[model samples]
Target: MKKKLLTVAIGSAVALTIAGCNSSSNSTDTDTNKLLPKDATIAFAGVKAPVTDAEKRAILASDATITTGSDSMPLDLEYNVFARSGDTFDHAVFGQLVDKQGNPLSKEDGSPSIANSNEFTSLLPRGERLFSVSQFESRPGAMFLMELNQNTENGELSVKDAWQIDQSGVNGGWVHCAGSVTPWSTHLASEEYEPNARSLVTGADAAADRYAAGFLDYFNGDESQWNPYQVGWNIEVDVQADSGAAPTATSKKHYAMGRLAFELSYVMPDEKTVYMTDDGTNVGLYMFVADKAGDLSAGTLYAMKWNQTASTGVGAADLDWIDLGHATSAELSDYIEGANQLAFTDIFATADANEDNSCPDGFTSINAGGNGQECLQVKPGMEKAASRMETRRYAAMMGATTELRKEEGITFDPTRSKLYLAMSEVARGFESFKKNGADSSSYDLGGPNHIQLEGFNRCGAVYQLDVASDATIGSSYVAKNMSALVAGVPATDSYGDGVQNPIVANSADYADNNKCHIDGISNPDNVTYMSGWDILIIGEDTGSGHQNDVIWAYDFGTQALTRIQTTPYGSETTSPYWYPNINGWGYLTSVVQHPYGESDSDKDTGNGENRAYTGYVGPFPAKAE
Candidate 1:
């Protein structure tokens, strides 16, 4: 194959240049006769090695190398920090809580409270200036906007102003997680782990009570107006930033998309079709086709039905979408406003299973959202309300598969007509057709036995879905089939035995303390696809699956997985996004969230205060066409 030469500059003041090459052995290589677009490619010398140093592993570390594609003059990875958790700008702290009037919030002791779990950071370029929105993942979630100034000469970004976006309009955001940038140049954020209104009002869940208490603070201790149904939807933020005046943000919640634990919603090239991944055990995959292009106000919701094709590895399936009906965001908002006082029993009729775990003939037996088997029948005249408000349960009632475990992120590959989804783990409902192999119809009953993998891999896998036009859906970007693209290899096959052993540190048989293969991905969370380069950037959110979470660069043409960045011991690798070109520069945005917050919490000591980091990988040169 012929190689294309490009120039890459390194260092601050002194520009050291070298030749970068784009060499591909696959059939998908760029045509030599055709001119490469400005966003087509970037040249890198080599991948970084895995971080294993005890001290370095306890903090963010990057050794990735880039080059002018020359063998010599290789450049080390350069991470540009935009801001940290508590960094102050525009008279407001980055992760600090603020009220509707932009006043800092305080805890019960009258002490300033701050959030450290920054999950998604999106940089939206408007005209000559740049804008960014970062969401804090907490009980009463918060989102902040920052105005950034780019030094055109060197591609360095500096935060000029920052302030929290008010969420009072949507009953306050909850558990904001992974997000994406829409085709219409807006920020699409997600509210994960939607509070189960059923359990919150029907039963006594201490965890739910605690969450309600914390969330009530967002309303100034107003419990009478607490509505769980108002949250758990996709939020779109339209940032209006002009040359002279400060930037203003307007947010709207898209209830047209069914309520579930959304990891992220990825809009296809068509702009009208969207794929939403639900995170958590016994969750379901969903897609929404909007009535109008670039508008999410009204849509038809559909859930995926997985038809198992293979039982080996992470399993393969032919996908069929189950239509869960449609509604407008305004209509769904009306339902929540009117039914705020209603309990789970008011919307659905339920019956307890017999001692032998068999439900009565009338009610449907299904398990969803990790909720145990329940016999439920949607009440009359509540089908539309049930479908939008209780999406997972309604999907199960419609015979859609709800067996996905920790389904995390979704990114589209327009060139290949493919969509990649991250399943943080391949365990629980994914490992068996029948829960616990029970013969009784009511025992651990779910929507359908669609996925049945041979072994349990807690290390997780990334699945690829083939997309094509469907006349029935009236959209050209519907997913038709799915299979594992890249999967992590667990240290042991815990299938059937039901014994999950911890990672054996310093084991001579395995490499170091890693429970999964050192080279493969572990707990893949948020993924982004670089368009012209055909590279999928995957980030990890793992605990025992791997000692340290790392970011990977998977080249589709070469089928090579390269470790590009590694985070601290307990931090999660998040918000890996590709901005092909912003002004004259290209960037790969990355966010390291909650350092030492997971398994390594006890290891957090000294000045390493476990703050989250929002930054980008590089300021690569913009390729020319």
Candidate 2:
């Protein structure tokens, strides 16, 4: 196998960057600016024309039924090494919840694993030696793990022998989004959201904290067991070789890292610093710097505040981190107790903590209490209980910028000291300031998260931020959005023909007017960069514009975006991960999330199609040495 070198245009001269480059330290030297070929051109589009029998069979087995279509491993990709070295040789991909006896594990309700019928799920593969596939079970949510069996002669990769490593009731899981495989070989799965269930707890003295009632109800209204401490935080699993078995693998819920509608965890090369995002209307970006490397049990969480410099949503803006303070799991538990015992007002003050005078009239904060660290004061009337438990609210209280809609996947470019995040959609006239909404100023930043302008693509977008290299520990670090890209086809006269951004009004009009413009992959969801190659893979979770979600690979240097694969209509292309030189293959793996509906069952449809598939495609062109 030869190492392939890519020549990119750099200051009137070509710079070479190797593809599939992995170092001995398990880190990569993937430089986006030097990875694209100098003459790289955008690939032209063509019809999806039906797939071959072999291709279709690889995705839809003889047992699967009740599906209109399936797309796995298109021509541009191949199976990763993780898929090849599996125990079975059927070359067949598997879904969640298969037992040791080669059967779909059933719940106490006598049903299969609670599959997210209509939600987004992220899939990530990790390992130091053997492969461990981690999937977010969005519904009745939980993270599922499976280890691939070593491949044997004539045996293709199959789940027939795969084991379900995590039990459903174990480690309290909820709806999750894109996650990360850490440098320390740990699986960090994020919990997307769970509505504040505290209001449901019926008690004479139930507290006003958002999660208070939910925790009480979880314990059957027993306030003594208010473990609202669980859920919504990042859960780290030990996926080591010997620890891959079920009931034995240890897990930790990272409480110090504030909880919110977590989207993804981006652990930096240093292994101590991490970047994470909140997914919802008016959210904030966060970073967690652990006390030490390889351990995330304790850390300082900071929220990002963006200073709007221009009307266009894109371009660089001044960024600063607000120290939100730190707390251990035990400290959070004690705070929850104090918040419940005392009146919420006594614990949280309505006046401004910082006398800088820029604090709004309605904002709230608690006394600094001389914590010895410069902490950012939160919103007016926000309780400390809410800050640690209901993190988004605390972030807003600290004067951290909010109103980030559906902040999703996050990935880092260590070589460039940059981080890219996905804002799934930026509705017209969107504003991060949620309070006193009518009076709040709405500024449109450029990129996929803003309204579509003429000749500008309107869908979702990605933002690039420059992270300071020598950011001091426990001090505010500065970062800025250097650029943003709103996605959609340039407003062309042909838009009316449904060749680009199509209009369907609603689901009822989908069939007749279903032709969607897929030229530009819209409503991007999961994003990951293949180091050395500098290829960024953007996965879509959209059911509009293009009902069939697609995955696109954007060459950073060449600026060429190519659609690599498209999922069945109504199905989301979630968690498209790219890895360099996996089993000698540059592989990409994705999950076709709930393609059709639950009605599409495992009946004999004669066509042998299913609504779901975990696609494995790879061994793509490795760098030639």
Candidate 1: what lDDT? 0.75
Best by TM-score: 1
Q: Which residue runs of candidate 2 sit more than 4 Å off their true CA positions?
A: 1-129, 150-160, 167-171, 197-229, 243-248, 313-316, 333-385, 428-458, 473-478, 490-517, 598-610, 621-625
Model 2, 51-167: lDDT tens per residue?
A: 332222222111100111232212222222222111132322233333322344455687544343222322223442345545544432434345443232211233323334443
- Displacement of the residue 71 alpha carbon in candidate 2, Å: 31
Q: Tell me how far candidate 1 lies from the true structure as C-alpha RMSD in angstroms.
A: 6.2
Model 1 agreement with the true structure over 1-625: per-residue lDDT tens digits: 1111110111111222223423211122323432234344343443343344443343332433332233333333455677788787765688887654556779779867788788888989887678899898877789999887776454556788897888877778788898999998899999998888877752234234866566666766556656678778899999997778878889999988988998999888788999999998789999999999999999899999999998877889999999999899888776776644445677899999777666788788788998878788999988888898899999998999988889998898888989999999887787664433333332135346677777657788999999999999999998998899999876544323244445533454345456776667888998999765668989999887677788888988788887777776677888799886565455788887887788767767746457777878765544443
The lDDT leader among the candidates is 1
Could you tell me the TM-score of candidate 2?
A: 0.67
Among all windows of 10 consecutive residues in model 2, the one with the lowest summed lDDT is 4-13
User: Candidate 1 — which residues are off by over 4 angstroms?
Assistant: 1-76, 99-102, 108-110, 202-208, 338-342, 433-446, 492-512
